[model samples]
Target: MNGDWLLRGRDGRLTVYLKSDDAVLCRAELAPGGPWEPFRRIGGDLGLQQGPAAVGQGDDGYAHLVSWRQAGTGESRLVHSTHFRPLLAPLDWSPVGHPNGRGDRTGTPAVAVDDRRRAYVFVRNAGGGVSLLVQKERGGWYPWRDLKGSSIQDQLAAASRESGLVEVYAATPERILHWRQEEPGRTPTRDETADVAARPGTLRALRTSAERTTLFFTDQGGELCAWRPGGKPVPLLQAAGPGPVAAVRCEIDGHDCTVLAQRSASGRVAFAAYPTEQEQAGAWWTESGPPLPPAAEIALAVDAHGTLVAATLDPTDATLRVTRRKAEAGLALEGWREV
Candidate 1:
């Protein structure tokens, strides 16, 4: 799982989905780091291109998940499911539905819920164009609507503000595109940001507030860069290795910021913080954390109380380990405990 895979549900409960050997497994913690429920197999006999993407604890108290199901021949399609009550026993999941018709080669789907509690799913289709589907406030999903574009290099990232404004982003070989829908039924607007390197990596967007969104991706040189709506790309950190970079909106001390975590070539995970606004240039990035066990990729999420959780697969044993950091701990890597 990549961007925002972990979701916070009722009572500070957290839900995450991962691709195990043969199925998509889901588990929930009553709180940030304790007494996790037994793994529940949600889908089986399946091929998953990426882990599940989810929107948690909507106004109706349901968590929605979307993922691509690949057939044995390698063709992919989109399927969705919902958890009616995420914090209860005998966890009830709605029947899986094929929302986007059959036989479409799609990337991992991205989901965002607006202030009105309407849910939207975004994905890059086989033709390289993006498609969107909406879940009505009453119930049920609309047919997939094509939002045309070409040569999208990776999966889409989406975030919504309290004002009901939804922003979605994707990268092409030459530039990154941003799409905005001011309100649910209004026409969406599109624009391209500065030109970027023509390589494939994660394209992530965070809505730090109603007024701003920050985009993060790996440039051609493998260095991590950040771009605001109309600003130039700012290189934040040098590339330590080749893999997906995971980020989440968080707050440290008295500052609201984006926290980034990535694995180096040697498999050690490092983190840095980029303040929403900085008074000094060099003060923007905090020191990198010490190396951890070798990991192929890292997934990040912030709990309800603002504790940062970092999850990765242990290289030696392939088991998922989750670690949490409180805001008071600053950037130290010393308090991580496996969940």
Candidate 2:
């Protein structure tokens, strides 16, 4: 499971969408930090192979999700749904719709919402090129528009800002490709980032501020790496483990920080913090704390009050566990509590 499957909604609620036995299950916290509701079957029976990619709090304050479902005939389709009242009882979801047309060989879909509250879904089309579908504020989805780029070698990541710009990134075999659109209904500009061999399906992106964005991925040598828009690729750790990497932009000790978490090669989950202006220095990854139980998947996020929380699925027992670190603790194992 990809840790990016968990998202913090606009209302400050955490919602997770995962795949289990041909079904897509959704579980969300009643509030930010605890007492998660029972898992609910949102979409299923279409052969969901990958977990859903979601974005919360679009213009309508609802969560938008996209996933790729395979049929018995071996045909794949991109499906989408939205939660009407994600934070309240009687939660409702829109009907599942195939946005990429039936029988399209699309990679796992990624979603992001721009400043206008319009939701954009990115996927690799049957031709191996990137394509996008847009959903407007009034609850209508536009037709698929091809972004027209080189063949995508991995899943895509997307980030948006209040200025109505949506940026999408994908890794080719040799380098990462970036596409930027300043507003909805506008053509996007394309560019290439650092020249490094990126592992498939490991690319992730986060918008740290109005003027800064960060990209994280594992390189061909299994080392965790990061790259900014115009900076060179920097290796953060040597030979990190094989799991999804997650990052969140938050405040730590009254300073802006980007917390990165991933499983180490020894099966322990560890995290490090990179303060502002130190991300590209290549020597700033804080000391990793004690290991947790071997995790099949991990998710990381920051609460409304600047608390760092982590959730991991224990591979041994197949149980989900959560831990949190307060700001004053500075990412130490002693400050982490299993909640």
Candidate 3:
């Protein structure tokens, strides 16, 4: 599955990422509700595979991407690249060596920028535990540290609070393992387990408030569930599908709401909105735009005008297809258009 492709910068322009046959491609919107510039290759590496795990910062006007490319020795080398934000050209990628060093087996990588403007990358190691590498604010990396959590699976979710504190989560066989910084600009000491069961590829974490986050995932029964740290797991909707779920916190019709999008079982992109952190309030899914490819991932964000935007790969081609709502049309969407 692809990593995050749609990102919004501090200045409000949208950056989109796509995977080509050999390289990772990116493009940006000319304006909030305008046409996008042509796609360009981010790096010269032909060994790059899959979409990148993308992170955009409002603090710094830059987009950060982490992905793995094959080395001459058949090792999975992890690399990171940054873009000059508000829609500028890409820069040279800085090499972030693999977590395992030898690059044996690494899971999907998760990335987030801390409040101090530093970036952290997390991935599942070969031992079924998590390892991390932290980049300093001015561009230097600390030694790779092994974050112990046995029997961990993929789909590790991570987010940094406004305070510059970071949290990393991994799904184990029977529960969720969480590691968080004790304070801003500090490395997390250890792992704390949350007795929550989530499907392997369906975990997503987004900030519900200034420095707090809520995790969303499907249960074994395929029902939507939400859990905030130090709180009980709240079962949301029944059978919200087992596909990748996209979420963002934004204001809708004068109310601060949390919005979620997922590809329904019938292949259409559908979404629902509810009060942020209030999953018990009940929410309904509304199908929007058109049906996407069965395996396509939806990228959702709020634009500069507070307008909600959703993007996905075209059902038949390499182009990006995007859909947004009308001026005052709630979730009712305008038609799908290409980048």
lDDT at 250, model 2:
71
Evaluated at residue 115, the lDDT of candidate 3 is 72
Point to the candidate with the largest lDDT.
3
211-233 per-residue lDDT for model 3 (tens digits): 68787888777888887777777
Which window of ten consecutive residues has the lowest lDDT sum in model 3? 49-58
Better of 2 and 3 by lDDT: 3
Model 2 residue 44 lDDT score: 35
N/CA/C clash count, model 2 = 0
Q: Which candidate leads the pack in TM-score?
A: 3
The lDDT per prediction is 0.64, 0.67, 0.75
Q: What is candidate 2's TM-score against the reference?
A: 0.84
**What is every candidate's alpha-carbon RMSD to the true fold?**
3.6, 3.3, 2.1
- Native-referenced Cα lDDT, model 1: 0.64
Instruction: Name every residue pair that clashes in candidate 3.
Output: 115-164
Using all chains and alpha carbons, the TM-scores for the candidates as numbered come to 0.82, 0.84, 0.93
As a whole number from 0 to 100, the lDDT of residue 21 in candidate 3 is 53
| Model 2 C-alpha lDDT versus the unseen true structure | 0.67
lDDT by residue (99-147, candidate 1, tens digit) is 3465645566777666667767777776787878877778777666888
